[model samples]
Every structure is written in structure tokens, then in C-alpha cells.
Target: MSTPLSLDRIQHAPKALLHDHLDGGLRPATVLELADQFGYDDLPATELDALTEFFRTAAHSGSLERYLEPFAHTVGVMQTAEALHRVAYECVEDLAADNVVYAEIRFAPELHIDGGLSLDEVVDAVLAGFVDGERAAAGTGRAITVRCLVTAMRHAARSREIAELAIRFRDRGVVGFDIAGAEAGYPPTRHLDAFEYMRGNNARFTIHAGEAFGLPSIHEAIAFCGADRLGHGVRIVDDITVDEDGTAKLGRLASILRDKRIPLEMCPTSNVQTGAAASIAEHPFDKLARLRFRVTVNTDNRLISDTSMSQEMARLVEAFGYGWSDLERFTINAMKSAFIPFPERLAIIDDVIKPRYAVLVG
Candidate 1:
């Protein structure tokens, strides 16, 4: 067997990420600084280390609702355009440090309106930050590309507006649309109008389904709303039956998901933290990868999960004995599944991803 890749090696490997949250992944020090700058005094901790520990501990509550509680502080500080730009800029710098060559970070533009910034202003500020970050990374000899997915909170009533906003800024670094929030009470079908609007405009979108809920949620996201991808579709494992001798059976939904090549944005650590799965070892990523499903690894919430793409890859390597080739496959799957145009995706794969991985293998 080949040697297991070290954390340093993993950090140096080229990677692609599809399912990361902007507000959910802020640096603890940034959170504290932004909070102080904005005069928001409801933080759970004062110092940076304690604030970091508080977020990590709070996210381990095994309840999705509780897992999302820390966002209030992050969002509280992100009301101004400057705060949004700084957060977006630092997100790129952090991802570049971890060697994520391509990433699509998602955030709700509607969430930053409390300080009187328009949705357009919010999108422009974040886009400017991405442009600046990419240029800075290039100067440092790291060619990282970043984009945005404008998200709408599912429990709210602004999905259609968010979808239109996403379409309005598609060429300006906003590549897709999404809806994310508590999944128990507010279903994906509630935003059918928004999905239809995106489809009508030929825009790409992914839905947060099969997480904190069950099969029906996945079914609606696919069958009814026509999701381009399933965010945390890990719960689709419920439809698969593994026999004693390792025979596998796929139910109708699972079969359809596999047959259609729908991407599953599997975030293993975040899944375990949210009680979506028992543990990292028990995550459906292994089974789904074995099944030849379009599975991609992700750090759903870097801060809350206390993870990076390298960290996620290392955990999978330890759990399933995955090798460098396996990591390459996941990276390729993510690139293919990105919401960018076909030719750009091909260029990234052929020019950036393949060459980088070949050097690593050599």
C-alpha cells in the first residue's frame, strides 16, 4: 500500500471546495475584532482563544439548530460593507494558505442589510474582496480562484429576491444561488418559485437537503425543485442497504441520484457535529465514493467545525485509508461539479488541477 499522506502534504495538495459557508467560517480573532468594531457586545467570549473554543464547543451540540447558533455573532458583526469585504478577503487568504485552488463560498446577501447596505452593495463589496484576494494570492505565487453563491435563508421569504440578485451578478463573480437554513420546518418546496425563476433564467443552484431532515427532503429537492446539487446529501445513505457479504442495494432515489450524476457535497466533520451522521468513520462518503457517485469533500463550516480542506482530506485518509489518487478524484469531481461555465471548468481541470496533482505524484 502507498504511504498515507501527511498533513503537510495534504495542505500542499491542490483542492477544490463547493460547499463552504462565508458567515460560518470566520476567524475567531476577526470575529472579536469585527464585533468590537460594530459595537455588538453579545459575544460568548472576550479573548480570541476563548471565542474560538466557544464556537468549537457550541458546534458540537449534536443538534443542527444549536450548531448554527454561533452564526448570530458572526452575522452581527458583518453588517457593514467593510466588514463583508474583509471577511471575504480573509476567506480567500485562508483557503489559499490551505492550497484550495478553486472555491465557491456562499453567503446570504440579505443577512448584511441591517447596516443599510443594499443587496447590490453587499454583492459588490464581497466581489471586490474576492478580486483583491485573488490578485494578492497570485502575487504570492498561489493561483487561487474564488467565486460566490448568493444564498437565501430557507425559513425566510426572500428566496426569489435572492435568486434575482444572484442572476443579476452572475458575471461579476456570483456564480450560483442557494437556500440554507433549518431544514425541519421550512422545506425546499417552500421556495419553488425561486427555483423556477432560476431555471427559467438558466441559472445554476444547489439546495441544502437530506440534512437535519430525512429522505423526503432529498426527494423534493431533486424531484420537485430540480437541484443541481445536494448540499450535505449524506442522509441519502438511508436508501442504500449493505448486505452481510458486502452486497449493496440502491433504492429508487439513490439509484436516480447516482444515475443522474448529481453531486453530493459531503462534509464529514460538520455532519458528525450536526448529528447528521454518527461519526466520521460512519459517514456515507466512503460508500458513496465506492458506489461511483459524484462525491466531493468539503469543510462546510471551517470555524464551527474547526476544519480546513486539508484537515477534511486528512481525516478521510485516516478513516478510509484513502490515497493521493483518491484525493485527486475528489478534487476533480468538485471542479466538474462547480457552477462555472463548462469551458472555464475544463481549463481549471486540465491546466491547473491535473498539472498540480501530476507534480505531487511525481
Candidate 2:
């Protein structure tokens, strides 16, 4: 067996994150500070240590409702423009510290309306935060670029409005649209009008499918809704079959995914936490990687999963016996799958991510 790779070494490697949630990754201290500013005492814990404990407990419940509970607190404190800007700025700072070179942070703008700010105002605040964060990181000789993905609540009825909001801010900072929230009862097909509109405008989009649901959801998102990428498409494993001699047979769906080159944003720890996979040891990331599927690693919710890109890569290294080459492949997959313009993506691959990895493996 190969010697296990050191997590600390991987921590310094360049990384990209595509599936993180804004509401799901607030710093505990920031949450407490924001809560105090708003005069809200509904927090389960007042102190930072206790607050961290509360969040850990809430996330480990493995129930979707419990996992969503912390968002209420985070969102409650993020109603005002100032609060939103602070949180978004801090998110970028944290990602830079973790050595992430590029990230696409997503949030549902509709969730931040308690202070009567319009949807545009909320997005503008977050965009301003990213701008500030980029400047701040540059001061420390490290830089990170952030793009916003406006998400629509799947169970809600504002997808069309949210899609339009994404298109409106496309030139500013918003790069793409997504549909988030509970995936069981709320199908992606419900937002067909929004997807159609985005398509008409030549906008890009990714759909959260096959995470909590199954292959049917993925099929609808791609075929019916025209998703450019598949978020947590892990459940597509259900479409595969194992032969008697340990050979794997690609089902029709798996073959299609491979042939079409659709990227799978696989979040290992979060998938395990959400019961989407049996365990990290049994995750299909290795299988998909071996099968040449376009797979990328991500931290779906850093706070909820208690993960960073470094930690996720460390786990994959341990679980799948992956080497630095595998890590490079994952980064290339993310760069290829990103919703950014072709020139920007090419610059990242050639000038930033690839050069960093080349030095690492030298």
C-alpha cells in the first residue's frame, strides 16, 4: 500500500470549490456577532464555543430539517445589506486562507429580505463583498476570485424571478443560476419556465439533482431543464451494475453521463452526512474516477460538513489512495466544468492551477 498523503501538505495545494452554500458556511464568531448586532437571542448558544457545539450537534442529526435549522439563524442575522456584505466578505477570506484559488459561492437572495431590501440590493451587497475580499486577499500575496450563483428555493415559487435576477447581474458578478433546497418533493421540472428563460438569454446554469433524489431527477434536470452541470449527481450510481467477476457494467445512464462529459460535483463528507452514500470508504468517487467520469471534489457546506477543500482532498486521498496526479485531475475537472467564460477558465488552467500543481509534483 502507498504511504498515506499528509493532510497538511494538501492544505497548501491550489483548489477550486463549486457547490458551497453561503448560508451554510458562516463563521461561528461572525454568526454570534451578527446575532448580537440584530438583538436576536434565538441562538441556541450565546458563546462562541457553545455555538460551535450547537452547530455540530445540529448538523450531525442526519435529518434534513435539523441540518436546515442553523440556516434560519444565519439568515436571521443576514437581513440587512451590511450583514450580508460582512458575511460574504468573510467567506472569501476564509476560502483564500484555505488556499482556494477560485470559488463559486451560492445563495438564495430571496432568503435575505427581512430588512425589506430588494433582491437586487441583496445581490449587490454580496457582490461588493466579493470585490472587497479579492482586494483583501491580494494584500497577503494570495488572491482568490469569487463568482456568485443565485439560487432559487426549490419548494418556493420565485424561480422565474430569481433566474431573471441572475441574468440581470451576470455582467456584474453573478455567473450562473441554480435551484437549491429540499429535493424530494420539489422537482427541477417545476422551474422549467425559469430554465427556458435562462436558455433564451444564453445564460448558464447547474441543477441540484440526484443528491437526495435519484437518476430521474438528474435526467429531468439535464434533458428537460438543460443543466450544464450536475450538482451531487452521485445517485447516478444507482444506474450501474456490478458483474460476477467484480467487473462493473455501465448502465445506459452511466454511459450517457460518461459520453456527454457532464461534470459531477461530488461532495464526499456532505454526501455521507446526508446519507446519500453509505460511508466515505464506500463513496463512488473512486469508481467514477476510474471510469473516467468528469468528477470534481467539493465542500457542499463547509460549516455543516466541517470541511474545507483541503480536508475533502485529504479524505479522498485516504479513501481512494489517490496521489497528487488524481488531485490535479480533480482540479482540471472543476476548471472545465466551471460556468465562467472560456477565456477565463483557460487562464486559470494554464496560468494558475496547472503551474501550481506542476511545482508541487516536481
Candidate 3:
């Protein structure tokens, strides 16, 4: 029999990422150059290696709020359309190199207005970048399709407007809308009008829930705010109790997530860094996967966590002793949960994911 999958082998597997953040995955060199060119002078370190180490360590603060401090630098550099396009293009290049065949990248448009670009202008530049990135990657024989999810900060009051922006860009490379921020005081329901508008327009969205907060946040995301998916809904495990004999009892909320097949976008490395999961080994990923909760693996922020889809999958395989069958299942789960149209999702599954895994699973 073949040996356990190595990181190199995992890199060759076709992967789909549903929960990566655009601003959170900037290259260190790119960040430095942009900051210098755009005149944003808030970098903790001037050197690339130092700045990379800064982000790597800052994310390990073990508090979700504290872990987010490094973003100010990334967001500071990404104030202009040119910077946004370059970042977006490099993001695709990096993901394509990681063998991600499909991805849905989310960014808050309001965060980029400090550079004087309108909301639509922000979305347009990003969409154009995606087009060029895809074409360039195709030339290198690493064809990838990327979609955008316009995110609104939950603590802010512009969600209704951001939702409008998301829908406006639906026909152009954008797929869905999302609300993300510190999940404690700012609940998903705080933006009820935005969710309602999304539903009324038949738009799709995911809500950041159950990561920094608990089941209450998840419940509101589902019951009231109508989230199509839960971003970092790792705390849904709270609703499940396991005994010494390995008997698990599911609470009502856990049952709903599993029974309804709601996808939990689980990011293990980032989760550990943010104090979401205690550690990679203690992560509820195996428990929830065994319980059939429709959990999919992700690299929530590549730069902060120093992770890629392949690296995330490698960690899970080592931690859980999962084989190719398990990895294939997780990849399929993510592709299925993607916000793309049904036919497109199925095509990637049939054409790319299953074919690649078939050789490994053998």
C-alpha cells in the first residue's frame, strides 16, 4: 500500500476553498511594496521577513479580536484600485499554485474606500483582477475559477448597502455576500435588514458564527439572519456531548446543522491561532466529520496562519490519520457547499476533484 499522504502529494490534489479572506492572505513583499508606494506608514516591520514573522506571531495571540490586529497593515496597503488588482491577482496565483481548482474569496468593500475608490469601483477592480489571474494561470496549465463574496462588517451599519453591492456584482465574478467581524457584541442579526434584503432578492450569503462566540451566534445566523453557510462555525460542537464510551449525544442545534446538511467552514490552523479550537489535535473536525456534520476544511487566512489548502489538508491528515478517501470527501464537501451554480459545482466535482482523488484513493 502507498504511504500516508505527504504535503507534496496533497498539493497535487484538486481542492476547493469556500472560506478564504482576500485581505488576510497578502504576500509579505507585496504588502511592503504597496505600503511604500501608497504612503501608508503603519507597518510594524520594514523588512519582509520581519513583517511575515509579525503576522505569524500576532495571529497566535489566542483571542479573535487580538488576532485581527495585523490586518490594519494589509488593509492600509490595499487602499487603491491598482493595489487591489495586484493583491487579487497574486491571491489567485498563490491559490492556483496550491492546486485549488475553485475558490470563493471574501473582502469588505467598505474597508477599501479610504483610498477614495467607490464601492462599485472596488468590486470592478477585483473582478478584473480575477479574470486576468485566471487567464494567466491557465497559460501555466493551472486553470482556476475564483468568485468573490462582498463582505460587510457586522459592527458597521453599511451591511444593507454592501448587500446591494454584492448583488450588483453577481453577474461579474461575484457569487455571494457575507458579514464578518468580532462576533461577540455584533451579532449576525444586527444586520437583519441586509439579510432580509438578500433573501428578498434571492441572493446567497454566509455568516461568521460560532468561532469567537457560541451557539447563540450560530442560532441567530440560521434562524433569524438566514445564512446559507456558517463561516468558522466550529463551536457547533458545543451542542454535542461525548461520553467516555465514545457515545455522542447531539443537542438540538447540532442536530439541525447535521440534519440540514449546513456546511461548517472549519479552519483548523487559523482556529487554533484564534483560540477557536484548542489545538489541531483537539479540534472538533474529526468528531464532527465522523458525526457527518458536512464540515469542510479551509485556510481562513493564508498569511496570518502561514497556511494553504494543501497545508491545511496535510495537518488534518496527520492529526486525524485520515486517508485519501477522507481527504476526497472533505474536498467534495467544499465543492458542493460552494456558492457557484449547481451545474458548475457538479462539473468541477466530476471533472476535477473525483478524477484527481481516484489515483490517490487507489
lDDT of 2: 0.90
> What lDDT tens digits, residue by residue, belong to model 1 across residues 246-287?
999999999999999999999999999999999889888999
The regions of model 3 sitting more than 4 angstroms off are: none
All candidates: TM-score: 0.99, 0.98, 0.99
**Candidate number with the higher TM-score (1 or 2):** 1
Candidate 1 has its poorest 10 consecutive residues by lDDT at 1-10
lDDT of 3 by residue, 1-362 (tens): 25888999889999999999999999999999999998988899999889988988987988999988889989999989999999999999999999999999999999999989999999999988888999999999998999999999988999999999988888998899999989999988889999999999898999999999999999999989888899999999889999999999999988988888999899999999999988999999999999998999999999988999999999998898888889899999999999999999999999998988897676
Instruction: Assess each prediction's global lDDT (C-alpha) against the native.
Output: 0.94, 0.90, 0.93
lDDT of 1: 0.94
- RMSD of candidate 1 to true structure, Å: 0.8
lDDT of 1 at 187: 92
The prediction achieving the highest lDDT against the true structure is 1
Q: By lDDT, highest first, what's the ranking?
A: 1, 3, 2
